[model samples]
Target: MIKVIKPGIQLTIQDLGRVGFRHLGVSRSGSLDTYAHIIANRLVNNHDNDAVLELTVGLCELQFECDTVIALHGADLKATLDGHPLYPGWSYPIKAMQTLKFATGRGGSRAYIAVKGGIECPEVMGSKSTDLGAAIGGFNGRALQSDDIIKITPYAQPWLYNKGALTPPKRKVIRLHQGPHHELLTPECINAFCTTSFTINPNSNRMGVRLDHNNSQIMQHSLSLHSLAVAPGSVQLPPDGNPIVLLNDAQTTGGYPLIGHVIEADLHQFAQFRTADSITFEFVTLEQATAAKSKLDAHLSQLKLSLNRYWAN
Candidate 1:
């Protein structure tokens, strides 16, 4: 078992997410940084779909009730285990009663924690991911709180230790594809959207990230848009003339004008962005977007093969 000493700004259990229910208005609420979540699980010999803890704006504290092996990945959370600094992307053994603490670090906005057998949380709708908006999954369907005891499997497994952490791309350029309503934007606005850099606003969250174009708001010819289906990565231009990028917990439908959709390959990096982070947008064709996804898949496959070889030793 693991106990939450401090829940930090926001902490919740997540898996790949609740899939195939979007048609019914259920959002695919899961870890904002999917790449980190998968890497943490892989390091601990856990399946990619296993439930893990997602820490947003780390300052979390946790204690182990039994001997276990675990892995930490994503943002440099400045995590320490038993007073010793812990590194990301490596599995470590923990003794019973050991305490682990984390502080906010640079480079990213979230972190992920994975145990050997994954977090043993009750699954809802075939997922362990927390849906904060609907309050339907994860631990009590809400953010973790102090004194919350999370169940951990009592099994051990072979995992690589002292492995090198994968370096995530730090490029601020995000590639996107034309959205359904891309035509609504004026020609000048389109040029500005593609060329200008935007800073993330403090209002960003799992639902959506509101962007500030440095006071140069993006304007569209149409002020009103009909409500339509939206998903994670959808970039909507609201009436306020600022673009909002919908995220994991965003509503299924939005009324704002859709200007573009960030490609899936960039979603992980996009999720790590925090307030004041500057990002530039570039448009890509569907072919380019599909190729990018293929490249990501190839990398993941290679990583899995390497981990399997290491475990066999």
Candidate 2:
């Protein structure tokens, strides 16, 4: 068990998110950076979909109530255990009554903390993710507050010390595939969209990230489109010409024009991008997107296999 000392800016429990519930109008609210979330769990020898705490903008603090293994991943967040610096991608053995704290780190906006056996939270809609919009899951379906108690499984495999995995490359260039409403965009609009760099707007949240097109227009001119189904990573162009990259917690459907969609493998990178970060889009073929996802899947599979061996021994 652990108690929240400071709840950071926006700390919440998340798994891989709600699955197969979009039809009921529920967004898949989960960790924004799935790569980090899964890696954190992997280091702790937990299942890939185990629930962990997602901390945004750092500044969270927690005190452990029992001995357990823990791991950190995603954004650095400059985490420390009992005043000792802790690095990401590696597991640590934390003693009872020890305190862990985090400070803002460079490069990313979110970090993930995973405890052995995962967080013991109630599953809502087959998932332990928090849906802030619906307020239906996670710890009472809201951001964690100070003094809140989070329970952990008492029994867990012994902590195994191992070197962390290599960090993923920081690619500010996001690869995108033409979206369903690609036809609505004129050639000049498409050129401008891909050629110009955009800054992530401060108003972004879990639902979507608003991008300022650096004074460039998203479309050469206005073209209205009817409402259509959308998924995470869908890049929609609203009336104001700013592009919004819909994320895990985004609405199921949207009326704006779909210009492009970020590939699944790269969504983690997109999620880690912080406010004011500069980004540019590059178009990719379907085959290229498939290959990238396959590569990442293979890497994760191997990492899981490595961690499994440690636990099995």
Candidate 3:
């Protein structure tokens, strides 16, 4: 069991989230940075979709009640274990009753910590992710609080020491594919979106990220459209003209014009965008998007395969 001494900005146990229940008005409320979440789990030899602790911002403090292995990834928040520096993309051993803490640092906005056996939480809708909007799954369906005890599920596999850091490139140019309403914006607006840099709004959250651009420089124009099915990474242009990138906990449907969709491998990059950070867009063909996703999938498969052999031995 791990006890939360201080649950920073937001801390929650999250897995890969619900896969087939989005039609019933459920958002995919999992880790915002899925790549980092899965990498942390992989480092600890856990399943890719195992529930791990998602720590947002910083200042989280956790104390281990038993000896276990843990891995952390995404957003280097300058974490420390017993006053020793612990970095993302690395796994470490914890002694019984040892403490871990985090401080504000440079990098992404969130980090994931995965224990060897994953977290023990009541699965809802076939997932163990925390849906703050719906108030189901994960530690009573909300951000963890101080003094919360998180139990780890039992595992019998022999512990293996795997040392490697998988770092996905931090890209300011996000790849996007044309959406159904891609033409809703005038050609000028589309050009401005792809060419100019937009700063992330402070109002952004797990649901979606609202972006801002200089009003005097770019035209704030978007044609109205009826509400339709929208999923994570759908870049919607509201009437006000600021683009909003839907994320893990975004609404099931949106009426705003869907200008583009962030490609799969690059979608997690948005999770690390800090307030006021600038990001540009790059329009990609469907073939390019497919190839990018396939490349990432193959890399993940190779990573898992390399570690599986060690564990099997």
A best-first ranking of the candidates according to their TM-score comes to 1, 2, 3
Estimated TM-score per prediction?
0.96, 0.96, 0.95
lDDT of 2 by residue, 91-202 (tens): 8898889999999977688988999899988899999999998997889999999999998975445555774865567788899899988886778788888888899899
TM-score of 2: 0.96
State the displacement of the C-alpha of residue 288, model 3, in Å, after optimal TM-score superposition: 0.6
lDDT of 1 by residue, 215-234 (tens): 35546345676799999999
**For each candidate, what is the lDDT?**
0.86, 0.87, 0.88
lDDT, candidate 3, 184-301, per-residue tens: 5678878888787899999999899999997524546636677899999999888777889999899899998888999998999988989989999999998999998998888788
Measured by lDDT, the strongest candidate is 3
Tell me the spans in candidate 1 whose CA falls farther than 4 Å from its real position. 156-160, 215-222
